[model samples]
Target: MSQTPNRSYADIRKALLAGEETALLDVREEAPFAEAHPLFAANIPLSKLELEVYARIPRRDTRVTVYDAGEGLAERAAHKLRDLGYVDVALLEGGLEGWRAAGGELFKDVNVPSKAFGELVESERHTPSLAAEEVKALLDAKADVVVLDARRFDEYQTMSIPTGVSVPGAELVLRVAEIAPNPATRVIVNCAGRTRSIIGTQSLVNAGIPNPVAALRNGTIGWTLAGQQLDHGQARRFSEVSEVTRRQAAEAARAVADKAGVGRASLAQLGAWQAETARTTYLFDVRTPEEYEAGHLPGARSVPGGQLVQETDHVASVRGARLVLADDDGVRANMSASWLAQMGWEVHVLDDVPASTFTQAGPWQAPLPALPATEEITPQTLADWLQEGDARVLDFTASANHVKRHIPGAWWALRGQLAEALARVPAASRYVLTCGSSLLARFAVAEVKATTGRDVYLLAGGTAAWVAAGLPVEEGEQHLASPRIDRYRRPYEGTDNPREAMQGYLDWEFGLVEQLGRDSTHGFFVI
Candidate 1:
């Protein structure tokens, strides 16, 4: 009767929290990890470690700790570590959830959109702007001005000023020279939301682009709300993907990839791990802790790829030890494996492999679940609203892109602040929930439905897709709250805590211009 070792969570916490040198092993699958995870854990599956412990860990004297979703997994893993002669091995009490709830850095995706937006805000001083009427008036009066739409070509195609040229947010910094040719051009940048527009104009102004760069006031929203006609079909005001197309795409991707594990070892290699009596088994689940908890492999650890990539050495200190990766899905595995492979270790991404236990366990929970819309809505219908100008709509983007510039009366609100924002919003009018992509926006609509339960629809494809359509975007400066910003800072400045405050702090402190897809609750949008 070999039982797993008993370890105290407090001891593991003491070491990690105090920044002491210790090995933190995570054993969880992938897809769930994609949602969120510990900032300093590595992935190594028990089955994989059973074969490659000596070759991988190669150290019998290191202080190694194993964790999973409680349920006696970590203890079993610890005992195996001992049998393999790992001099000092312990189990994380309460497994993944305990570590995260105790202020550990839990990670989500790479914090991309938010950072992209931050780049925009930092480049210029709010790029304060004026309305379309004002800009048109200036043009009519022969004012010397050039307009820049910091959106994609598709966005431009959807709706854009005849004179405005498309320049995606990332491209603005390098391409501003092309769009705002002369210093006297008076450059103005706009996107459906304020981030891109602010970033674009600010980039030029900050870099001292000789011309005057300003955001269009109220962006396209102002243009339409001002009783102006939106160029439809030929030029839409924003992006709209047909529901049929999106659903088809989703259906096409129906469970082809394992989403969590990759680079599986052959039977021989697995057998080697099991026989490696002189090594420690470090199982790392790159998925988020919550995902690990809902039910992961019997002894899989959790790392949540982002953290694993950033803090590899810290988690798997054995420079050459075995690292088994499990993601909630392949996305995290693929993304993390690319980085780990470059670090000179024998790293394998184990995915497309199925565990019989997982299939039999029923539905696994999502680490971060978005609120769903009570009523189903179509993109064309939402597009109709933008073209008609019959109603003023707010993006109500989550932190992913938080509300930027809106038509004259449109507004922006934090996902956590939805209740208050909605309370302030008129109940009689319909509202639009938006995020980077429609994933979170759809959830936002769901939250609204569950709470205010008002007439709300998600922005088709979110604003990024909107910009892709070559839609008219009103440029303006909208400020985001970030610890890096001179005016704001986080308490401890961390990325591991699953706490709401920490999420917001990390969203800013970690250079995420657009992090956490607008909503703070379980609500989120997949980019």
Candidate 2:
């Protein structure tokens, strides 16, 4: 391991306050990172270290401080990064506890930077909004108005205002005319919480949309607090854009994009930018998740403009990296890029990129690297082994996927935690591995063999192949060897969260502007 140095919280804080380039990463799962972290620290999770670090912290020499809550994870992360050719990796002196001792602030929830910026926008621009009672009254009277949910479709499905159509933040300007049609119809934007609703409403106003627009103040949280009813399982969505409306929205968005000083790049220019080895370039498709999953540029990530603005830190942890955004309809990318440019990103919109370039699609993700060589066992062979009790199966897949379907008796294990996880399982005559794709399982074969000193094998073609071959699979969290710490459960994600937790979440968001003021690291500038 490289003898990487340690960085004091005070020194890190000073560098942040001075606006020097730095990435303070919390090398823990999203749950713990959300539970508490320094305001500007981005959660990269040690499990995803190799998968995400290169793109997030683009500059190899950019100073990076990794921390955990005394979990002894930072050192391991630092070493792994060194192996990956990161030049300036360091530990946050004493980890989370050390920061606390140094009198640093700890924040709750993810995307604090974007949420804080939304508060700042409202403070500076005085964006108009309607309280729950007022919006409820409007809906009750059948006012000539349309309520647009400016969140993800799943979020809208979880809970929404009655009669509201799903029009995510980036789509507000592009699809508003089609949803309301009538120039005189009022539009009310909402999210589960405040950021998207505020930004979505402001997006229309900024784009010069004719209809009077307002945000549902405090979003669903406020509505729930006000003893109002919320709609569930609603599938209403924005209709396709008419040619005339598309042109108008595109023209308006381009104007805002220009005002924000966002640049335009041809495909060739973007390719050149991507070719540059010294800096990180993040190419995003700023359309809806469904649209992105349908098709997008091969190397581009799906961020859906509004979420890109709301979770900028999550998308690009390196403060100085360049951003290139794309959308089938130009309006979304332009609007999203405008906000990012204003927020001090070196932002641009991809122009004149051919529709053919967007042929590859289906859930944006990091491409898997080549796995280490391992002995392979056919699904039929593995099934026979299981039936004869000759081998034990471990599935190195995501907890959610493992819950959905897996080999009947397979144990779920995270590849990063394999060493510790081995203690939980019964000693087997031989070990077998599998995952949804089997690629990740292949990556772990060498590690498991080295750690356990046992013969190990990878199931050929994984669960998909097994299913294709008509093998029986079991569902649910039947054999979890590790806690499901990979993802953070958001207060607004499902219907089961306590109302008090949701309310407290909203309350915390309301105070982010104050928190941003206390933490001077954020160099945000709104247009």
Candidate 3:
């Protein structure tokens, strides 16, 4: 991961504030970087840096700071840079993890395109927004006003205003008819904080969605500070809390638990879940494919939890199915479960992990492991079950690297489109998930569980693990090339798909990409 010598956080933060042309480089996995990052940090994963070193960080002399989850991964990355001849390379004193300790900010919401959209919203108003009291007065007088929560349904469930309905940011374009169905329904977008709502509301204005739209000034934080009452759902509590705001969100979480009311399943209930295998019973690892291959449950999918939830529909079609989730990091399970609760499923976290009926395959994965040994599920079993219940199969074997190879009958569902793609699955079915290695198969398990809440299983290792274990390996991302936005979120993900997602994806894509090009801050390392 080495790039060059070094720099300091204060120096870089100042340069950023002063609008200096410093390149804020984050050298972590795309998934982790996407979770939270600096406003201007462009991701250039440590893995791919060796190959695309110059093209990515064109300016050899630009100041660069690298960081990891505090494992000193950055130091190694720095060394890599020095060998490559890039000067002015320094590790983030603590990386993103360190920034938090120093009280530096961490941002959420994946689409950087949304940030541009927010600017458009701010410009539309041109003037400061009405005060809370002013809006309250209008409500008392029954003036026309509509508040829209712009986050995903999963996010909306956690916490929202009493009367607001879920209208995700991407929906402003596709579901405009639903939001302002009558033409007079005023729309206002809001999230826990400002950016998402600001961008979401503006996307409609930019797309000409034909409705009076505005943003909830300052988002949920503003509402609560105004002494207004917020609504809590069975599983979600509306507040501005995160790993970044855990202490603050605690009260809200409890209120949400109280309002919607959730209870842990008893041992009997847990046993019942183990018995329901009519559909695919997927056990996903939710880590990188490399991590998955290192060691995971014998049979599980390998969709990383973040990617799984983000691309739910593409993984499975079942709406009311059963899903079980697992993650080495409990935070992933906790954060992921919050979303699963909203999608509606019989969800379990398997807190005891290996102690339960399911056991982990073994220890950590190497970059890629050869297949293991196991007899195949007879075609008779697959064919017989295909009739009674439901099932669909996908092969992530392409690895998002350079289409290395694929499973014989695997289909390619790009991580981003997996959600909309999988919406077509039947609720009462099951499916076998495969990838080049067993690691990704387990991750696919997490995706299936989070999205469709259906049953699923993994090939003992992977297609490779299976073949090494004596299964099979096909070749490609999918059977058909229907044109997709397959660009890896990071350099290590390697190159392939379009910089932007597929057309008509979630409604707000095209315009956002266009604006992103226009805003010349630091270019997106992953787009």
Candidate 4:
């Protein structure tokens, strides 16, 4: 194979400063990518390249650069991109070390850009915040206060402030009025850590909400450090908005979007943007997953506005691509577009569209490369093969899932490292590949067959299908062919994280504003 072209840190930084379209991808597992990377680098691990590349970097001709920390994954990823029809793939000169040598600032953790922007917003606006002890005193005294958790509902259910209601970030501006009702009621917003709480509280302040609002400083991390107990399995959520509240919220959200210089697009204009072959345009439905699954605009991906802001690189890999947002409730799209615009994206809110216009139903379907037809096997038939010891099952599901439950004797394998994994498994007459839904495994059938020169078959519906058939399964790490590095466990995610890790995470966030100053390419502004 020919060598991929190398791009220096100066070259990539110049394009970003010029506002040109570029994709700076870090081809390492999430754990390593989270340790340290350049400011604009998006984590697209080499293992899941085929699964995510087409949908993320939509325009094949978009300038793309891939890098890794001296692991030799960059060249492999560049070669894979070429095979996938990407014409402008290149390797970052000197890899991660090279970027450091060139004086590029390295950032830690996922969603660095959004986290930095949140800190910047706080510094510029002096957004009001209350310490955990103060908030606890108010709760103890039964003051006229309402604590709204701005993290996802599931996260809230895991561990939340006492009497904290689940009101995700995007829903803050839309639902805060009804939740607080009286203008004198004090409102408190919080998340597991700092970013969401700051952004959520600032959203209400920016929209001119009547209530006295403040973020729970350092979020749940602060609460825990103060020796406060958190309520688990809480289900309190925002109720339906009144017609009067809806109108007020819509007006407030629109004004905020306008102040941020966010653009508006009619359905006709959106169609024209979608039809452009030269420019990559992403249409996102910035609503709750339930609302999106019930009905959404065709071609719109269901990315809750809060998550879309937090994980911009994950959803829209192309840095300079145009973003179009949609929501039945007028407040969500506008509020979300405002933040995207502040983040230096050319964003537009889909305006004047009726709720009935959202005709698409069910979950978002990702675009995938066409697969060659592969032979299939039924769950029962696979059971027979396993019983006869004639076939080796290669499960391509996530390592965590495989450990939780999998076919009795199946070996867990990563599709990207199939060659290495294959050598570890005992020789068998045939191989059956499977995953959660067999989608990923189908894409690997050709490769597995070519490598082993053996008959390879796909499990009709993957391991999920086998479970549905009431087939016996077992759980253990007895047959892992590849290491479990696909996902990075965030220190603030689950309930059992160590206290030291949580405090360290808070300290890291407190320093983000200074980091943003050092890396001046982030064109962030507060309205």
Whole-model lDDT per candidate: 0.50, 0.86, 0.50, 0.91
Q: Output candidate 2 Cα RMSD.
A: 2.7
**Full ranking by TM-score:** 4, 2, 3, 1
**Highest TM-score scorer:** 4
lDDT of 4 by residue, 1-527 (tens): 53899999999999888888999999998888999999889888887888899889988999999999987789989998998889999999999999999989999999999998988889899989999999999999999999999988999999999999999899999999888889999999999888899889999999999899999998888898899998999899998998898888999999999999999999999999988877899999989999999998988999999888888989998888999999986899999889889999999999898988989999998887776599999999999998898999999888889999999999998776778889999888899999988988888898889999999999999999999999999999999987777778888887788999999998898899898888888888888
lDDT of 1 by residue, 236-302 (tens): 2223234453333222222211232225553345447746765444566665454566666644555
Any runs in candidate 1 off by more than 4 Å, and if so which?
1-308, 311-322, 325-380, 386-410, 423-428, 468-470, 477-527
Q: What is the TM-score of each candidate against the true structure?
A: 0.31, 0.91, 0.35, 0.96
Residue 328 displacement (Å), model 2: 4.8
Summarize candidate 2's per-residue lDDT along 176-251 as a digit string, tens digits.
Answer: 8888888899999999889999889888999998899999998888888888889999999888878999999999
Model 3, residue 233: C-alpha shift (Å): 2.1
Measured on C-alpha atoms, candidate 2 has an lDDT of 0.86
Pitting candidate 2 against candidate 3, the one with the higher TM-score is: 2
